[model samples]
Target: MSNPPELPEFPSPFNFINNVPITLVELRMRNFSGQIREKPRWWEKVHDADIVAKWRSEIIEQDEKVVEQFWGGEKRFDDGNGEKKWPREKITGAQLDYIFDELKDLAQAIDHETGIQRTAIDKVYQSKTLIPADLKTVFLSGVSILESVPPEEQDWHPGANDQVLDLVHPSLHCFRIGRSPVLIPERTSGCPDPLFVLTEEQYLEMREDAEGAIVSQFISTNYQWLPTDFEVSQPGRRLYSNITSILQRFLPLFERVLSDSSDPPPPLAVAANPGGWYEDEESESDLSDDEMDARWRKFHWPVIHDPAPFSPPTQEGRTPLSLNGRKLQVIIKLANIVLTPERPKYPGGSWHVEGMVNEEIVATGIYYYASDNISESKLAFRAAVGDGTDEAGVSWNYEQSDDRGWTVAFGLRQWRSMNQELGSIMATEDKSSLGRGRYSAFSLSTRRGPSSRRATFPAATIVVPRRAGKVPALRALPQEIWDMIMQYALAGTVSLEEAKQDRLALMEERSHFVIEHNREIFEVEFNMCEH
Candidate 1:
């Protein structure tokens, strides 16, 4: 046949073949181009076939030489004798190259699901008649090399080539690619060791997540041991502020989480948690117990002391906001008066406030519904006035806990001064003087309200001392002398010159009368002449 003339150019390369118009055979060839004409692509061996086998073998041979060099031409076989041992040394660039170069040894079959032998892979790649396949492989050989090298043997000093690190990083497989899990390297190098295997972004992200978790843990459990502003570093400052901001933002959710009484909490759509810079050493470490305790008291006490922004408790019809300020003030004043006989030092009472406001004691009583003996409205408080009793052996009216019952009592002798009301208040076995007298010493008998076993203060009832039937002998003093005595008692002052010249001064100087409240009255007669 005569030589066929050239066909007209078509839009695509497969539009025509052998000087003929487009056909099925040409289309088939176009669809599977490289299968019929196999070309060995060594560059793509890692993802295709074992063309890089030679490269892998060479790198392994080089690694052996590098190992020899590391030992200074002397090898130790660990002969189980104490006589000879190899000294620890840093790795070299040549060793790093050999370690990373072994990545080429891995080969996958045409299906890319299982491993294939290097010999079979080589045949698949070089065979001219063999069909092309996506014979991808996972490069575990380099990972094996890295895993074999101990961390101590790695050169961890700075000043390594960035390109070399970049080349070695992909083989370490620190993270995942799609559904496949990556294999992290056992050995690392460079200052900030992760730099040898992780990108800066990845490293930063990991650190940030870790710091946030630490912050969360501290907020949940170690709030008492937080560091103070003076003791905190710059990063710690950021951590504190960040945590505070996060708390403020999600305070309601946290309150709900905390208040949930059920076994399994209801599902909540949590907000994006903010990150912080709380130092792991300061918050997470167990070292320096005393120092941590001090810091916790210094830094976190204020939060515990105030805590107004958080959820305020509620009583009958009152809220914590209404009760905390003026109400607390009134309670504190009365507590001071009722608790002072035995409590020489005043650090303020442990007044737990629930709710507030109104005119009379009856209408304004903080109602507490006791679910059970142990379960009462959160609006209750327990206070301690004195260590024990006054000289007269009468216990100062205050809260006391025992195995059987917990006596929670409070009274204000001068209720008018506090601008507080009184009403149907409960009494305990110990007997409180909180009676329904407008201005009289209001005392409530202990056994009047609830059983001593449960010791539940009645709802809508206040605890006050009942009025004493007899006036304490200290009140029997003449008003003038009593006023002088009170002034002297308050001032804790005495002078001889003033005593001889003035009646008030004489009373103050001649006698040291200790007016004991909440107990029997007694007077101490003093003779200045004796002194």
Candidate 2:
């Protein structure tokens, strides 16, 4: 083998992952720089077991006393003539009004910026859009306050039963739900917040409720701290009104954020290309007929096809694989092909190759031989006999077959599954040509044979029809598609059985998706290793 090309320089350790300084904004929010160490308590230093035990007992007693007085003490306000029971500190109508005012000021500040001053605001807005809308919808479903009284648990606020907040995601800087309800009894904190002490039965019921209930619930029966407007027999109208007013103030913000990001980019297309190495035009001339045969045998002899040490080089200019001047049998697996329709017009195509591997699928795809005599290597593709629908399928067995659909050249690599061109075609919707073929296009296999072999069809020979729209074709292969191809290449060729064992081993490994940004590109990465 020849000396390999020099690898690209690795990026520096402190290099910015991307141009965005959003990381700085996130770090600032955490305020790690301002964190202070706490002084250790006297009990922490007391090694004497008896003394430590006494301190713990005393602390527990004091905590109990505090809880009792906060709940039971009748702290009264001395009015000029009479004493009235002091109301517990719960979210009141006035507090709601204050919250709205504060939020209004923030929104106004966000909208007031111009030119350079708007940079921070724009970054924040862009960051907000990164979160998914379905996730926001889930959070905005709001909270349910469940009240557990002795053996029975009921919703504390009845209005919550029928109300869906339709509020913005808390992460969008709209507003955050305050302290979560704690699972303990305390003097200052109680039921109005949906704060709760869960009983075994209530916990089980909550587990059953799950996502089906739509809203989150916290159960506690301490209704004494509830707002004055809450009559024991009725829904807390005043408290509901306050919450309604506060959420109403945030409606415009949510509307603006959602509207600005209404249309999202289409999902990335991903596939496992079971094909072998993709070579370029530059490498073919160097090999003699005997040398080529040896190389082919080396590549295909392994039970699991491994495609390492080579890839379709972007610099050398990739070309289609040549079939050594021989008319070879091409078996196309309908299951390996991707199609546009959701409820596909043709179903059960996968059964054609239910128990086979990539090597078994011939005519996986046809390719131009990258020379003047392109026609000899190019195989004729036609609609397979018998199958009449626009669905992708072709006959692998000729004697037992009749009609089929159009076939296209699949991949330049031995594994046609990695062909991005084919993927794009599969992803596209075809335009009706008034029953006339205007140009040329590719297609997948169709129609099952009586035997176990997957349906086969010739690719690359059909005259494609004219496409409907002016959708701009991709100028360069997307990084995502390229990376996926590389991953398949590195994984080498492994048969289904080898793949199963490796998957089991992977189950025991720690893995996570790592994302890295390169200027305009975001690369999502995962390792496919065989341990």
Candidate 3:
């Protein structure tokens, strides 16, 4: 084989892996520049035996406190003001808030591996034009606060019921619920902020009650801390206004970081996946060709035997194992493929494929292969697909959408259960095309069959008739259709030969541009790998 290309030289001993900074803006690549090491605590040391004895004593004390405050505390208090009347110094709301603040600070410092200063994660996802509206409508649904009253606990806060937890998810930002009504005497330190989001619909359904219940229970009872307002200016008097900003966080990623108690990950080493082991395993499990053919025939019938008067295209194609290299099937999904009558109609003739299902129009999204030019050893794409009524109701599977339904291709190295796949560019060319001012254009799979390098209509999408207004047909390749198909070299779509010509032209233009500004064109990077 050939040598693996070396990573482009970057900076010194503080290299990318364990050192380079990354942020939302520079999410161009996933490879990191650092090591994941266990942080050791120093300076405060004790002998092993002494440490064990101290831990045992602490456990015993905690258990005794639990029992004294919860099980029998009720028998002691007459008016629910907790058992022992501990002073403010013993335990105050201020103390616990400080602990959370410290933890947040420590977490930030620990995760300070930095990158570029691009837009925040939440901002990119919030664009309506970037994501489909239906897909964006995600949030929390319902919330109810439970209060626990361990009578003999501290009067300042008393029982565990006083500890209020606000669980905010997508649709619903804050569901500040007290899990168990029974409260502990002193303040509970870990009132889980495992914020689970609510869907827009569920939030609308239960928002009013959940909000009221949380507010009444927290301020009216225990210590209020978890930033009731964006900034905790007057924590004692802040209301639900702060919920919006605090809720604005990228809840999913934060939740993963904070609450995930995942098992210890398996070590990453070459010995774990030796090549011979996989080969032998596959050899042992080989299936007979005859059996494979029999199974194949089972799926060979025309998807649509007696097609509907206005039939849709067949989207039930499998990854013809005959054509399998890498499971990656990247199709530039456009919005116009949406053919459900509830929303829009197809461009021309009804759906017809090598096989068709007896439906009005081929339901919608069709999956297929890339062009020969895309045969470059490695290439990635930016993609978008329609999430409409066709994908809803019943014809397709259950769908999840955000507030604004525009979709974007994030990484090519993902197994998307949706349209389009993405990755990095290995090598490529480009080209451009022009609309004949009139004839309708349709996109179809142009992958080569096994027989020859010759291409065939392996698949086709049912085009919904688009009324391209004054948006010059050539320029308006319909955001969905022309977005990815544009030949990179030409700045738009073009024939193979034309794309090659464009590549040459771009190289020449770049050469001139660089001569005009040579210093910056070729960056001189320094490295300390060996030096």
Candidate 4:
């Protein structure tokens, strides 16, 4: 074979990856001058001093029998000094409130003979928007699509080393444009519109007809007519409907994130000379080298201030995200991790985003529908930050030489890649049972935004296949001729086996691209002296 064509280079570092142009926002570095938005700690929300004081006063005013009845019993404790203390003084405000809330909820559930709400359980750890108990049945039905496939037919996640089984992964058989071997186009010109999205009913019907097949006949045969006359399969019909229901529940949360990300909080005003410990030049001149160094370190390395409280605008205040009448391109994935006596623990997953640039996924929603006998797992998130060299609109009025102080104020470290830890979400498990598994479903939504260079589909008429007996013209054709016609019709598309290999290759290429890109953006050291 002759030498392969050389890959063209682009001006930007994050231009083309795996032959697809990356979105600018995909790896966009954030400035560090703004107030960090973080979820409040459990204590902060529930343990307000004023609220606690009012609760204590109320409890003290009540009679002993009334207090006992309200609290389910006499909640008294002996202090170290041997003084008897009621729960008002002994228990924290948060603890007392949580107890009362739980008692009230339990009483209501018992009276109505209904199951306790998942929100009550989640409140113990202050987790919000969890998959409620009632909705979990629908989510679990979507997860049950995995059972239809045989053990041998199941496809394990490519980079996960057989640890993760992809029951309905979009990466396996994603919609493709252009020719074989290179499904993704190099440029957006002449590419089909990537905006056509499947309706919930259409998506479900397609999956239902596929019968657990990885490749859909409708899409393969009508590759040129995708997003119009094509069908894609994943998780069966029931699973698709259930996933739609589950996604509806998470729409508000997704909308909130989208809203917040688009319009971030403003930065807090930095004081001219914060901490008030910097010495004048005359005082510094009098100090010895060791004393000066100590002073610099103290001024530079005072404890990094806590992030500001995250309080986004309420739904009524903000403009509503209208998704009605709009078709959505959704990628569904159901995953389960089983733990037995032999394998008691799971090591968790590597740091990675949802999809490659080709997928153009904007928002990802994960629902932990089932977790039994598993340890408390959490999904941590981090983002790339700017190197602070060219932070516009920020001017530190402190001493010019205090480079370290600026780094500390920005919550960044010198001589390190600027990657900020953006907290994690708890995927709490039930430790009541043993040797069970955890099941979760992921729904990733992709849209064709202005910045997106993803490919779309061309409008075309669908050629519906008819039964052999129903089509007299087809029935009259010889077996060999009919086979030739079928082959010619599918000549534009690759086989299921070829598609699987291509998916693996694409995943591997994307993985390497992400690793190298992350290294370039986040692993390089920052030197203050050079600046």
Name the candidate that leads on TM-score.
4
**TM-score for predicted model 4 compared with the true structure:** 0.52
lDDT of 3 by residue, 216-243 (tens): 2211111111111112334312222222
lDDT, candidate 4, equals 0.37
- Candidate 4 lDDT by residue in tens digits, 114-180: 2112222111111233445665665456555654568888776666544455555555554444342
Q: Tens digit of lDDT per residue, candidate 2, span 148-222? A: 123232211112222111111111111011211222224223323222334444433533222222111221111
| Candidate 4, run of 10 with poorest lDDT | 453-462
lDDT of 1 by residue, 1-531 (tens): 443232221111101111111111111112122221122443245443343345445444544554354333323221112221111122233332322232233222231321111221111111111111221011122222422456554322122221011111111211211211111333212212211223334433433222432222211110010011122454345433432332232222221221221122222111111111112334748648897766643333100011112122233432111111111111100000111222212122122121111101111121111112221111111111222212111222212211011000011111111111111122221111211121112122232344222221111221111211111113344475446445534443324333223333222321221112111111111111111
Question: Residue 319 error for model 4, in Å?
Answer: 3.7
Off by over 4 Å in 1: 1-43, 47-50, 70-72, 77-220, 223-531
Q: Between candidates 1 and 4, name the one with more favorable TM-score.
A: 4
Clashes of 1: 26
**Best of the candidates, lDDT:** 4
List lDDT for all candidates, in order: 0.22, 0.22, 0.21, 0.37
